[model samples]
Target: DHGSQYVSDVFQDEIAFLGIKSSPSYVREPQGNGIAERFVRTLKENLLWVRHFDTVEELRLALLEFKETYNREWIVGRHGYKTPAQVRKEQTAPVSIAA
Candidate 1:
């Protein structure tokens, strides 16, 4: 689903050309896309709200660090307190091993 920024004509055209389905969440219906909203809130609270960088390079570096830490260290309640990386590893574990 496209967020508010994707309401632009360029984004709509791109999605249309790609044949990707686009659905916008209804106004005042946060539960419709709760995961995305939660992610946005976390990003704002943890990264955007905490720092002010003068240069794009600085911001990029900070964002990279934030993403790495979030994936590797952050314990998400939704995943039973496991980091996202751990959940992905568990999901991809081999069912059978060769002798």
Candidate 2:
């Protein structure tokens, strides 16, 4: 999806400040882009917007904790109301087939 945030003047200016050359463009799959945009929104909502970290280390620690909590507890309907950890476990679990 073509989210306004990526192309917003403020966002562009922020990236430019960090020496990043960001360009917004269309992708072949519109649906996939929405996933990325939604993730950015979720990350901002859950972690960035709510917390004020004093240092990069503090931010890193918080992000790690957030990731763990998200994967272990956040239930997604697409995964049949299962947490990401459960889905990953099912995916990687050894498959047994009785002969």
Candidate 3:
């Protein structure tokens, strides 16, 4: 999102520090955010909805495990049917932001 909170310098610094890519969809273009939206849906369906955690630490651990499993096993069409780990391993293109 290009919303104020997301675009704020504080938020951007945190994202950069964490080494996560910050790619916001073009304004008013929901289609551009499809991948992220799909990820949230998948997370809820595969983990959140089906599991219960008694504590935040337990949930965090579960999420960490889920991330590893997802990156290693999930085949995504957008990545040409490759798991995220595969795609990342093959990635060599330079990163850029579009205006």
> Which candidate comes out best when scored by TM-score?
3
Model 1 global lDDT (CA atoms, 0 to 1): 0.89
What's the CA error at residue 56 for candidate 2, in Å?
0.7
TM-score of each: 0.66, 0.68, 0.71
lDDT score for residue 61 of model 1: 98
Query: How big is the RMSD of model 2?
Result: 6.9
User: Considering TM-score, where higher is better, how would the candidates rank from best to worst?
Assistant: 3, 2, 1
Q: Identify the candidate with maximal lDDT.
A: 3
**RMSD each, Å:** 5.6, 6.9, 6.6
Question: In model 3, which residue pairs have backbone atoms overlapping below 3 Å?
Answer: none
In candidate 3, how many Å is residue 2 off? 1.9
Off by over 4 Å in 1: 2-32, 97-99
Candidate 2's residue-wise lDDT over 12-85, tens digit each? 89999999987555666676667668878989999999999999999999999999999999998878999999
Q: Over the stretch 1-99, how does candidate 1's per-residue lDDT look in tens digits?
A: 456568988888999999987888777877768888898899999999989999999998999999999999999998999999999999999898789
Instruction: Score residue 61 of candidate 3 by CA lDDT.
Output: 100
Q: List the candidate 2 regions with Cα displacement exceeding 4 Å.
A: 1-27
